[model samples]
Target: MKINLFPLLFTIALFYSCINNQSNKNDLTPKPYKVSKNFIPINKAPRIEYNTFNNITQNQYSFTNTTSNQEVSILHHLDETGFHFYQGLKFKDNNLGVIVGGTRLRARITLNGGKNWKEVSFSRFANSFQSVDFSGNNIFIVGASNYIYKSEDFGKNWSVFDTKYFFKENQSRYQKFKYYKVRFLTEKIGFIIGEHERHSVILKTIDRGETWKIIKNNNLPKNEKGISDIAIISADELIITTLSGKCYKSIDGGVNWQLLYSGENTTLSSIAFFNSRTGFIGGSNNVLMYTNDSGKTWKKIHMPYGEISDIVIHENNAFITTSFQALDEAKSFIFKIDSKGTNTPLPFLTKKDDSVFFEANSYAIQTLNNHIYILDKNNLYRTIIN
Candidate 1:
């Protein structure tokens, strides 16, 4: 016998081939990313119960104390401007403020806090202005069609900069670009976030608003959604929320970014940080999350069914505004979240049937002194917080 081992060798080769094929098939299968276990359930979190009341006759609103039945009037001022949809509100100080909006590119200024507002005219190249921010006397407003209007005299005059020049190579590929938010970390450094056809772009201005440079393409995440909001913790550390509920953090002054948190398929509209380690993110579908360890982990807080339009932190407390709309109903609410994660709904409420209520859309929130100014679709509301 020649001790032939051909059949045995063939069997061994066939077995190894099957194992290799099975290994590759396993590798191709998708695996779920592990969500953090830091979320606090609604039942376990501290919640305050307060009654909301709106007095149509007095043009005021009030919230009842959670512990006591004492009614406290919160509505300090309400400006009912007809049909003008305000998109962004910012206060340069306790007295000077500016609000930019749509409905033929309207801009309003108030010198006496929120007590009175007057329309300020500006040259219109875009139909709407989405965001407004100020660095000293230089006010920057960004809007549709890649237009950025800068006013060195505080909305007295305007100079427009078409950001399309930054994207000259792909300008013809997209019809228009919309800038959602403009944030100035300091007088000389600022950022404008927007998208051209759902692809997000961030522009950095190092020399005030005179010039801008696009953040390097390789430095940003490979996201295809718009950047909804930016939270600047410091000149070097910053965080941004996206339309698809993604959060990115840049510690090197927007030079390099890393994905901080992946949201649960919601649109994160606003993000604000009270300190370097504490932050809050709000978005669509009642998504409100907080992080205490910078951006390392996040904990979701239970909120009423509504979309969070804007968030602002005052005195270490987060003030949130929410708007909910449906075919037959519309509602808006203001809530406050303390540092301990306690949620208290401020007594401000609006209904579709109200004479002053126009639409339950977005609310731009700002805090000055001890008051919160909210710019709604057709009205401006100022509420005192103590």
Candidate 2:
């Protein structure tokens, strides 16, 4: 869900904020100006080159070919600093990720998919980066504290969003906790769920991230256990699962929720919806549960024998990422399915080990602009789903 930002947090300790509202709209979309200068696209593959600025030679942007492979380009480096303080990456027309500043304590933001970067004092003195998400061309970046910042025009300018309107936590979990996952269904509507009892929070923004409202702890079946993840079905329906195998469907956004699927002892980590009645849930021990009659009842499907971390449904396509090894493979995997949980792992990117830690093991996946994006550590990579 997020990469460690400890190194970057130290780097950007002295750095402060940028322009408050909006300024760098120009920095994100440098197209129509120049081709070979502002931005570059990986055709066959992008040549791996060392960045002298930071003296790092890691794969900044990777596009697989014959020798390379068929997996979409997965971003590996963000700061180019020997210290990898990569937080998360976002893919629009261009890809953007965060880097840590070495001179002062500040995190640098990179665009054009890590080819270039700009320093932004976004994460200052943060213990860890909880989670990051993109909405309304605005970047909502959160860390170990109650801090949350929004970037306008890609990563050029940023503004802080006061999360106190919808959040109230006095325990150390709120002060020292980190976010595990974030999701944005619409620019103005979405949710972010994380760890800790009270930290298993849910937020909704009708006016983008300009403001937030907490819908957790509301009148529900039970809201004690930590939430694993959430998937939006519609304006009135959203499917959420907890680590206790408690699966709930919210017919009124998140205001009121009801149980759709449960097994008493199933630790469901991920859930996705096709329309309203059709959905799937993934949990511990390679378990996959499906509901065809709109959450009325569910039956388990034998998925790949492994720890299924997350699942995504688009039309008839279901993309799943495996966390643990099936047996002793130990390496992470990606599988695609149609309607049912039966899926074939994409052979192109399945290697012994990837450049980044979890390129093959990542759990953060977002679809935008007709492309599926995955965030492994601080790098963000994308591909046109074919």
Candidate 3:
């Protein structure tokens, strides 16, 4: 009788173990992701035709030009001490553009499409400039130590607004306010996102750049540290990406915010919307996400590079710049993403010497009239997008 009981109990235990094993195996199986019908799946997207310019040397200026072929040609170079780095670039049209940067507060303007650049001088208030934006004849530049430079006559005369008073009434607090990006929705309405003591700060200007006020109830997440970029859909709607990989949307002009996407703890450096309902966000760790339904949902797009520095969308194509440091060397790339979610890599300027000036870590790209203008370190390059 004892022997009979033992055999039966052993049999029952063995059967249950087999069932559990099968269940665990089923749990490990990969499941397919559900994508919206409006969005194209990556595997099913169409491939775009493009060319890469890999052989252009640092000293050698221009690449081979063709209608269908993309060319990377150096337009201008800044070898002076104060103009060794370029932080921001904005083109007013096909013929006029401005670039701002620093070893000290420095900017260069080209009226003939980067053929010639003239130095723009600033008062010795801020040591560096980070970003620039323009609407019509009015140009706004933001930079370190709470400096906001406004030029109503297209960089002819400068009016500086030191926003330290808007933050805290102290000198130390003024130094802590660093403006990273400036965006103007219209000639009169604009937003600036930066940092105050390592926390994200947003400043709003309803009267162009004449005056600014801090957006107090921005409703940013408690853990959000710094803001990487801001995208304005309209005067009332705005989106911002944080250094913590969180994206927030404000429908009521940044008075209140709603969390749209919480990323995988990576730094989202750039965001661009081709339209109100479709956009792309790029970040560290080769993270590139595309959302068709605004920011309600996002899908990962495979990127071959590590940090995405900037994203510019032109004519239904998204151009992305990414850079990564490798063994004391920096490598950069330019990728074109089409409406169908296809990604094509374009050629970028390679380092010809052991100099850091040619390293493409913080380069910027802008497209106008079928030409792509790139600001790389102290040099400016142009490429035709065919």
Candidate achieving the largest TM-score: 3
lDDT score, candidate 3: 0.70
Extract clashing residue pairs from model 3.
none
- For model 2, the local distance difference test gives 0.56
After superposition, which runs of candidate 1 have C-alpha atoms over 4 Å from their true positions?
1-83, 114-126, 171-174, 217-219, 326-332, 342-360
lDDT of each: 0.69, 0.56, 0.70
Deviation of model 3 at 44, angstroms: 60
Per-residue lDDT, model 3, residue 101, is 76
Q: Residue by residue across 278-307, what tens digits does model 3's lDDT show? A: 888888888888898878888889876657
Q: What CA RMSD would candidate 1 show?
A: 18.8
Better structure of 1 and 3 per lDDT: 3
State residue 198's C-alpha deviation in candidate 1, in Å.
2.0
TM-score of each: 0.72, 0.67, 0.74
RMSD of every prediction: 18.8, 15.9, 21.3
| lDDT of predicted model 1 | 0.69
**Candidate 1 lDDT, 145-218, residue by residue in tens:** 55566767755445566665665555253357788899888888899997877788888887876777778645
